[model samples]
Target: MSALPRHVSPARLPEVRWLRSSYSTGANNCVETARPSAGPWAGLVAVRDSKDPAGPALLFSPASWTRFADRIDRL
Candidate 1:
């Protein structure tokens, strides 16, 4: 199994700075992303709902996140 966690609490990530997409509107209906700078989450991209800042943040490797973004771009 991968050593990276599937999800984490945003509250525990003090070193991460979440950012939403520039395309997002004032409604805040999009997601936010961050790169964990330390701990087990380091080097992984963290994703969470903009509406749920305190909710669980999903983790993804840089490559995986890029591939996912590529797929979305194709749509």
Candidate 2:
């Protein structure tokens, strides 16, 4: 199996409003997303598992996040 990428812990990351995707209908497997207040990643998006809020957050650049959204939309 391929190794997964490492991410920073959500507890260490700045606090922000974590919004659930509209597509998630109170599901346990939903993803939660938030934006950091300050850092090299300010304005960047961070995503994590809703079931594991304190777990690692996957950071993404604005452009990268847009591309990811587009890909998901296409799917």
lDDT of each: 0.90, 0.79
The sequence of per-residue lDDT tens digits that candidate 2 reaches over residues 29-49 is 888888887865567788899
Cα displacement (angstroms), candidate 1, residue 75, comes to: 1.1
The TM-score values for the models, in the order shown, are 0.91, 0.81
Give the lowest summed-lDDT range of ten residues in model 1.
Answer: 1-10
Q: How accurate locally is residue 23 in candidate 2, as Cα lDDT from 0 to 100? A: 78
Clashes of each: 0, 0
After the best TM-score superposition of candidate 1, give how far the Cα of residue 69 lies from its true spot, in angstroms. 0.6
Clashing pairs in 2: none
Off by over 4 Å in 2: 1-6
Model 1, span 18-61: residue lDDT tens = 89999999897999999988987788899999998989999999
**Cand. 1 TM to true fold:** 0.91
Using lDDT as the measure, the top candidate is 1
